[model samples]
Target: MPALDLPFSLLDRSRTRAGEPDAVAVRATVERAHRAEGLGYSRFWVAEHHAVPGIASGSPAVLAAAVAARTHRIRVGSGGVMLPNHVPLVVAEQFAVLESLYPGRIDLGLGRSLGFSAPVREALRTARTDPEKFLRDVAEVRAYLQGRGPVTARPAVAQAPPMFVLASGAGLTLAARAGLPVVVGGPVLRGPAPLAPYRAAFDDGPAAPAHPYVIVSANVMVAATRGAAEELLLPDAWAMAASRATGAYPPLEEAAAVRRRSLTPKQRESVEQFYDQAIYGSPDEVVAELADLVRRTGADEVMLTTSTYDRDELARADAAIARLFTA
Candidate 1:
């Protein structure tokens, strides 16, 4: 088999299982990173989700520190840290510290999302929803990282870690104006039309890249058979569907349990929609689909955000993806 020409990476949300403690999920994320480094994956990223029972990685910087310490080569970073929930200087300092310790292995992927619910947003003390403010904050964070801010961020390094925007909707424009690379997924992946404007509007700032870069993220799974791969996606799909219907993102449950639950039509539709957005199949099938996705989006990299209840199966899936490129 031919190798996938571009780099591929992993993003672990540290998803908790039904009976497991949150710590287990966090540790699993670190372990997954270790395995990913050995498997020849390009980067390993963690996410931030506050007060969510299903995701244990509320502090991406802290978790990234841990992952960085455990691995020697693979790039480690947040996929990303929510900008609305943080101060620009603080965000700069945290990543600066990570870069100080790990050198070139750190990344800072930022997003404008608030907490999952109103109360969580209240707890975070972030009510700002203005897109312009988010753009300014992103610029401020970049300024600090690049040593151009009025007040210098501490522990300043020779070079700042690279930054990326977790883009959606108007986020493409924000990233273009800010001149940062983008990690895009979800509805935007249905077609390639949205990326054209971003490329056209891209600004080549001092800290920005000369050209627009896109990383296509998705829930991808590979197994011995198509049915088996789909089964692995059930837990995450069910969790997403349940979260939408009940307003609570629960820990991942077994596929058999998900199969046993009788769902309302709306919930069933939600589950199907989740499946529709994902790419999962046997090895050959997945390679063809991912190649098609790269062709459509012109992505510089592919980031897998796959999660499942069984840790071993998840590991196997990661190995399978790695083999696709290495073989």
Candidate 2:
């Protein structure tokens, strides 16, 4: 509830670990999400990334249950579940069970990307299709939840919680048309351009709220020293930037190591530029920036993800951001 006052949600992973060596980090991250519920965070979302050992959120629905079991009040859902790989009925059934157990604390954020490499894509054995197919799955998901889809799956639609499309491109428009709420996924790293696209195309449909429902996810990291905060966050920013540029999932390389790697001139430039959009600074500095983000984007919420892996740091970050209003 406090995060709602500040309107910050927690984006976490259930299965994916950042640094290698395997099993330990994966479990630790899930435990971290469960513990984060005690903090003043809103929804807790796990993303769907496959074949990347570094990615722990591959089965978001399953992870949602694990997180929900451990925590009491905070909402739990997928930051995104890539919709291209599976059948609609299956998702409907799986989440149906989840919604039944957890009730109101469920969110389903869907994405259209494959979320894996070509080889991993083949291993999933899913057929690649047109973008429109993504919409069909959405419709099917909506129909099931609204209790209108076919009865063959015997899906408990009416009992299912809520679902939203997690999109980077025109996903807001599709969500707007469907009258479902949407959270603008990805770092506001691209800044207002990505945010603008989602807002410009939002439609006022039957289920539409009078105001737009936009929660821009922020890659914010704050600490005592601006340099310290940036240092803590650089690894993630560097990793994310690398993945975007190469479409190759790499381990969470140290920022310096990543910088020294075989980066083209343009790639180096991109990595530097991406940080400009993220909130990485001291508590005082971050408050000024974070407040401006909400005011500028008209985003109803901001999901903070970066170095939340450290509890003391996270508590300080929360306190600092909260001070803006209290002061």
Candidate 3:
């Protein structure tokens, strides 16, 4: 397959597998980052998911520090740290410390998502999802990171790490007004219509880039055959379906195990819907589809968040996908 013209990255949520400790999943994420650096991926991002059973990464800043320590060249950051669950000053300080340690290799991707469930939200001290509050928090975090906030964030560095907004509807407007780049996926990637306004409305202020930038996030998998690639996606798809049906996201099971279990009509439909949104195929097919996606969306980068029960298979898929971006 021909190399993709633009950069590509990986976003690992430190997905846990059945019968494994959460520590193992965290370690796997670090190891994957080390491999990602060697494979020539532009960046390796971790995610934040509070009180989620399937995802072991509750703190992206902590995970990003671990990843940065292990990897030499790959950019390390959050795919995002949800702003609603954090204090702006504290969030800025945490990422400032990371940037101080990692220097030019750190990134801070911010999002507006709250915790997964009501209990989780309460545990996070996040009562409601406020878009305006999120916008203010994002700005405050950026200000602190840039040394422009009222009080200085300690261990301050000469430069702030680049921030990307994980955006959607109001998020696009917020990012545009803030003049920050955006990372969008799901329905936003279905067509170019959603992004056109964002591009048109971009501020491009002194704190922002000269132009609008977009990073497209997607669940991508690759293998020797289309069937094998599709199989790798089943674990996550099944977990998502179960989560939708039962409200508890369980650790990923082996694809074979997932296939053997029977599902209710709603659960089955959920699984199929998950599959419909993901891109899984042989290398050539994935390259073509991703190329088409990039062409349509005008994405500056593609962030893959593919997860499977088998660590070995996931590593191989990562290497194969990396080859499509590297020479």
lDDT of each: 0.91, 0.67, 0.89
Where does candidate 3 stray beyond 4 Å? 189-193
| C-alpha lDDT of residue 80 in model 2 | 79
Q: Report the C-alpha displacement of residue 135, candidate 2, in angstroms.
A: 1.6
Worst 10-residue lDDT window, candidate 2: 318-327
Q: Which model is ahead, 2 or 3, in terms of lDDT?
A: 3
Runs of candidate 1 exceeding 4 Å displacement: none
Candidate 2: deviation at residue 160, Å? 3.1
By lDDT: ranked, best first: 1, 3, 2
**lDDT winner between candidates 1 and 3:** 1
Best by TM-score: 1
Q: Pick the candidate with the highest lDDT.
A: 1
Cα-based TM-score, every candidate: 0.98, 0.84, 0.97
Better of 1 and 3 by TM-score: 1
- Runs of candidate 2 with Cα error greater than 4 angstroms are 1-6, 14-19, 127-129, 152-159, 185-211, 244-246, 254-267, 307-327
